[model samples]
Target: MSVKKALISVSDKTGLIPFARRLVAAGVQIISTGGTASLLKAEGVPVIGISEVTGFPEILDGRVKTLHPNIHSGLLAVRDSEAHVQQLKDLGIETIDLVVVNLYPFKETIAKPDVTYEDAIENIDIGGPTMLRSAAKNHAFVSVVVDAADYEKVAEEIEANGDTTLETRRKLAAKVFRHTAAYDALISRYLSEQVGELLPESYTVTYEKAQDLRYGENPHQRAAFYREPLSDQLSIGNASQLQGKELSYNNINDADAALAIVREFAEPAVVAIKHSNPCGVGIGADIRSAYQKAYEADPVSIFGGIVAANRPIDRDTALAMKEIFLEIIIAPDFTEEALAVLAEKKNLRLLRISALNEPAKKVDNLFRVAPVAGGALIQDFDYKQLEENEIQVVTDRKPSEEEMAQLKFAWKVVKHVKSNAILLAKDNMTIGVGAGQMNRVGAAKIAIEQAGALASGAVMASDAFFPMGDTVEAAAKAGITAIIQPGGSIRDQESIDACNRAGIAMIFTGTRHFKH
Candidate 1:
């Protein structure tokens, strides 16, 4: 399987000349089209234009090039088959021993702000994918290279053996399919958007590996981080780590939870998260006060937890944070003095994400996917927010103005917590939180116990309707004066009766936020 002729048509020209020169040095004829042919010719490499082989000039605004029968027959011909060889000889078509192609930057083009529909349509490469697929299909005889990163290995293999090995060709062919699949997915997603179809009959998504994490949630598991292309939203995946060790899977998960909770507050706020659950959250006049309140809310649980702030972290907040051991600290920005102080702690992971200051916007069209044993569960993202008008008073005693504000804050915090979640808040700070319990009563009890003396006048928020009156009775015993829940349980009346008996005010949000 010696190399004779190679086709090179690429949009990404990285290492093009060097790779082309290597091929030419090995006595292989180089056939190229458009910019690739011009660049190789300028580099003093002997090149044959695609039109010379196809006997047809590029037409339809350069869309019809490399799609001729001559190119396809050369790439699809089997060397061992006499009939395949005779067909190529009869047509006077040279066999293409290799194909090097990369698709147009369709994802990059659409990512740009204000890109027009016609602009995106024009950038879709027609002949490149066709040639790559043709070469890949006949991988036993022809090798396909879609990634520029494989140039060195490919060149060395050809230089050493006069051709790529079957193994390498097979691997390259697989890569070609994956590359084309992702390209097609991006095109499909874009077209669906154009047609105002948020959820199409079929959904496709592609992600590029970002990094290999140290490990998964447990040390025994392996994991890698990946991200969607052209995502500009505020997220842990897109954040810049300014200092400290690389993030582990748990660190990323906890940091994501912290950021999600902190973003719920528009004012200066801080959220402390442990094991993907918010242990404490606070909103204050400034960042320092917010940090202080959040830390004090659950001092024991905040140890080694991740902290996220909606505002720039100042020196006083840094001083308070330094007093405890923390896994990660994330914020929009940090003051010079604050960074200097926190720099003393060598292992603390610090991240800077300016998008934190911006309001969190819902990505309506994207689906939240969770992998199962044999398949995946896909559904729309929960972007439901609590509106003032959505609140309904269900108890005889109405919530005071102060109680109403704290109830709203508690409701927002509880949404990010795991199922069976309960949050107790006072003065715009979460004094206690219970998450991921097997039963709602157990979660309520845990939150009440954590609040201690703070539970006396605090408002409680439940992620879902109370199943029975036991949770209300537990709240009453802890001295919680106001409660907010979705109020859709079959035993809702029993819980309402319990609230009335305890002289507590209750409100229904009419919407349940059961996060799992």
Candidate 2:
């Protein structure tokens, strides 16, 4: 089929002029609308205004330009059907053989800091999506393009064979649907949030591909990373990789866990993560001391783990880190001397996230999504923390000021641990962590065993309420002084009685942090 007429309308005009010249050189008449037409004419390219093709002036601020039957019939007419061709001839409409279009900057507009609702509404391109859908629906007869990156491929094909191949048109048609679906989804999400409807009856979300990882959790599984558009949180997605090898699936997961824990601290802190669980966490006067405390927390587990720090790394800290086989070291910044010292280990990944220093902000619209067999579980991100007034001492003896501080520190770290979790902390450092066990007592026993002699005088934290008093008994036996847990279980009195019997101080925060 020979190329006859092509419509070109796009917001992103990256390669527009050259591609349009290629189309014009092929003897194809070009029809354009609004700014596209003006730009083409000024660039010495022959162009026909959209009104000339439709014989109707654009109305409603250019919203009613392409909805007319003249444009739709031109795109929808079947070239090989005698009846379709006859219908177009009866209406005196020329067939549109090609369509080049991209939607408005809706995503970019809403991403602005001070974008108004009116501005966002006005930027939603009604005609562009309509024409693209119409063209894509009839892709068997009309070639459709929605991405500027595809201009060269379409231009070369038209220059060679006068039309895109059937396979190319089919692929472009599929891409058009995806593009429009994502655009509409973004608009739907923004409007829903404006009206205070976060999770509507029908939920839709979109993410752009970041990279394809080497493998997933295991070497046999495939994996890739997708990031939300305009993510403002202090996250792994926003971190800059200063050095080292590309991140694998496990590397990204562990790094994210380490980052999340490190963000919980405002002071200088360090968190070491292994297999998506924090093995050690420490708060200190500086980055170097924090790292030392964290390493001493669990020296065995710190090997080959991902380390995240809330402060910049210096030469002394980097020197101490070089002695171990760490997979990744993430910090706010790295001094020149520190970077040079750490560069000796070529395979170590170093990520710098400046947002670590920024104060934490509340994000109401963010959600945590986990996939199941055939669906997903969605919930708001866990940003809940207990205020000082919210803590209730259920035991006969109240926790000392120092023990209360340690309890608060343990509570923060415990929330990030897996289900059935137990943590032992003292002196602003986690001495032992027992996570992902089957029962509360079992978790406490593991934690107590890890802490050994250190368990004496240390505090314990549980992610959820104990179903029985065995966990408190175990904590008392381990010489733990105070404990913190959400107290809502039916057998909560049993645990309280056990704490009173052992003179252990226990506080209820009335909240559960079950991470699964």
Candidate 3:
């Protein structure tokens, strides 16, 4: 059960020298290959080259090293089995008590700018994973270490017990498999993306844990946060939490919705979210004006909501925000004065995302995944934007220039709302929003009622077309002057006729935005 010989081959040489010295002090012979052997010799640690043990030279640009039975047999031979020991003796193979290895930086190589296909392929480690798996499979006797963080504890255990305990070996083996599986999955995903194969017969993805949350959507449910590696896109995953307590499940969800809605505007904008749906949204020439307009949109709902701003928040904006009991405030940046003012609310979560100032770009992994009772559902992200050329004037009267601008703003806000959705807007702010209703008319009625007198001249936006004219009638009754929707229902003419009867202008976007 004592470690007499250990093989070390690692690309990440962190803490390698000290660990190697510790093994040498314990009378454990170190066998190494390539740069690892060179570094050990330079550090004055007694080492034996891999060629000395295998009696074969490394070939094919060092790709053929450690693929021989001389190496794997030493790792795989069962120490307690009489036949295994006899085979090792017959083949003149020594027992390898431990393996220390880490794979090539394939993920880092592919992440580089202008990296070639050959570069990525060359970075894939064949021998490293093979050795780790071989040692891991025989974990009852051989210990395998993949993570540098485990080196100190492993060295301590070996110094005290003369060998790593069976429990430690088993845990290390499980970690090795997880690490190799994630590595293989990354390689597979990169190759699949190159061939434009998004959905393959087998699918696998991996995420690194960011933090453990206190609870999930409810207090009883446990949860954790995981982030995608090398994700450069501006998202909630990449935001830096500068202040406030840890984010809860609902806080992250609502903040993500607020950020997404605010990003829809090129101008200075603010969006307030409640329960993962946009309660208020506004665009203005400056951050202060924008926040004011967003607050005026729905003062009651904005009380405990999440607020996201596209522009840097200033003193005035922070002063205004301090009046509310907001759960979180996210923006590109916050002025020193603004931070000092907002710091008064110790529990308010503050997040800064510099990418918010940059123009939006296409992300590599653009998919929305939702978990169901049994399996899951995956679909393309709704990156669709309304274009000028895609608009079709279906009503008799055309929208005025002012009405058209409000219609566009309303359309953008409606896309982020839950369906069936109805949103009313005036100027550049949402006045009322009704989302997640069972029927279209019911949603419209709720929006109209919320808007009240504000609905008289406001424009309405629907995520999808109206199945019946009742929605249009409801809007007309509320004095809504303009409407925007994707017109493709069997009773489209009924809605159009209702719009004409009320002299309301309407436009069909030829596309729908349905959020579930």
Across 188-290, the per-residue lDDT of candidate 1 in tens digits comes to 8898988988777777889888999988989899999888886775888888887899988998888878877887778889999999898888889999999
Which ten residues in a row are the worst by lDDT in model 2?
Answer: 354-363
Q: 1-516, model 3: which lDDT tens digit per residue?
A: 899999999999999999999988888999999999999999999999999989999999999889989999999998999999999999899999999999999999999989999999999999999999999999999999999999998899889989999999999999999999989989998999999888778777888888899999999999998887767658778999889999888988888788778888888999999998888898898999999999999999999999999999999999999998999999999999999999999999999998686645545566667879987787777778888999999999999999999999999889999999999999899999999999988999988888889999999999999998999999999999999999999999999999999999999999999998
lDDT of 1: 0.91
Which residues of candidate 3, in runs, are more than 4 Å off? Answer: none
Give the Å error, residue 230, model 2. 2.7
Against the true structure, what is every candidate's RMSD? 1.4, 1.3, 1.4
Clashing pairs counted in every model:
0, 0, 0
List the pairs of residues colliding in candidate 2: none
Deviation (Å) of 353 in candidate 2: 1.8
Total backbone clashes of candidate 3, pairs 3 or more residues apart or in separate chains:
0
Q: What is the C-alpha lDDT of each candidate?
A: 0.91, 0.92, 0.92
Q: What TM-score would every model get versus the actual structure?
A: 0.97, 0.97, 0.97
Model 1: ten consecutive residues of lowest lDDT? 357-366
Q: Given candidate 3, what's the lDDT at residue 402?
A: 99
